[model samples]
Target: MKQNPTPAPIKINGSNIDLGEALPRKIQDELAHVAETYFGHLNHATVGFTRDGNWYCCTINVQVSNLKVIIAESSATDCHKAFDQSLAKVGRQLLRRKQRVADSRRVQMSAAALA
Candidate 1:
């Protein structure tokens, strides 16, 4: 049986709206899923929601390691939409980071072989 590790605690902050039950749970699950999918481990995460005029803003901060932090923010008319957009951005950022690390290792190995 594959043991499932406990997800890292997520801190949520919002302004001018009741977060309600479903939204928080959804956010927690989605964020944890995304973090695990990209980074394999999540150190910590913080999600913030704010309203600016008609737009709802969502900001997600994910710490995959002690020194590395990824932040993505988006605004939409609905909170859910904002969260989705921000989450997409975070996914892209994490993918890029993972690719960069892979590329660097490949380059080092190739150079070593050449020498």
Candidate 2:
């Protein structure tokens, strides 16, 4: 059976609103819960929040076990929207990473089987 490792503490950087001011108990709890859901799937990650003009920007840099490094950035009028977009981007990255690993293993196995 595979055991999922505990998720590390989340660090947030925000513009306009201070970290405490921007996230209330409910919001902070929700963020932590969602982050933990991904747990061992992501080795390490950094999330940052900023704003420009009328847009809120969120950027996440993550390293998955099989994928060296992946970056996802999105802009929205709200922080939650930005997070949603960024998560979507990361999901795509995960799929690509998994596919690449599968392909590589297939090639290696084929070579070994032939030998």
Candidate 3:
């Protein structure tokens, strides 16, 4: 008898490549946890945190099973707020995209029936 293969665990990779003080280690761990818990069975994740003077920016690229998701950078004078807002933006985009894919499928099926 052949054994079934289990799905691979998601991969999360983050770096404070430019601004260490702007993003604390605790926040980095939290970001990884949130992504694993909520991001549509993500296959891979890449995150970068940076700062411009007092402003902090967080950027994340999340890959799901079937889509490539790019989130715009989110910035604020407060580091925690900037990080939270960036993740929230990604969540909102996922919701909107889910609706769009469903709508497109409906249209395609309707057009096919008319043929």
Candidate 4:
């Protein structure tokens, strides 16, 4: 069994709002897990939150590898909900990228086998 590498530290920034205890540890853990599970390592991650009127906006930018960068944003009535939405979006993007890479490799292997 191989162990996944530690993920990069996450940087959080807030605008027009006081984050104070709002960024949940569970969400950070989930983000780290996603990075490790998808790419085994994370080069960098930045999460920014903004408040506009009654809505909260969350943006997450994650660099999983030299060739991959995932960015997602969402807006909701609460910061936590916005963050969760952004996380989910980023997870889907990462999964799709992984699937695409796997599919390309599989195709290449099959082509080579036929040659």
Cα lDDT tens digits, model 2, 3-81, are 4666544556676745455443433454444444443454556678898988889887766555577788999987778
**Between the candidate structures 2 and 4, which one is better when assessed by TM-score?**
4
Which parts of model 3 have CA positions greater than 4 angstroms off?
A: 1-39, 111-115
Best by TM-score: 1
Candidate achieving higher TM-score, 1 or 2: 1
Pairs of residues at least 3 apart in sequence or in different chains that clash in candidate 3 = none
RMSD of each: 2.4, 3.7, 5.5, 2.1
Per-residue lDDT tens digits for candidate 3, residues 1-115, read 4322443243333344443454555454554555445543555555666777788777767665477665646988766677678778777776677778888999999999999
Off by over 4 Å in 2: 1-4, 18-40
Instruction: Write the number of the candidate with greater lDDT, choosing between 1 and 4.
Output: 1
Candidates in order have lDDT scores of 0.88, 0.67, 0.62, 0.85
TM-score against truth, every candidate: 0.89, 0.75, 0.62, 0.87
Q: Kindly list the per-residue Cα lDDT of model 4 for residues 1-115, writing each as its tens digit.
A: 5554554788888886777763757567888888778878777898999988999999999998775678999999988899999999988998898899899999999999999
Task: Specify the highest-lDDT model's number.
Answer: 1
Q: Give the TM-score of candidate 3.
A: 0.62
Worst 10 residues of 4 by lDDT: 1-10
* TM-score (C-alpha, index-matched) for candidate 4: 0.87
Instruction: Record all residue pairs in model 4 with backbone atoms less than 3 Å apart, i.e. clashing.
Output: none
lDDT of 1 by residue, 1-115 (tens): 5424877879999887777887899999998888788767788899999999999999999998553889999999998999999999999998899888889999999999999
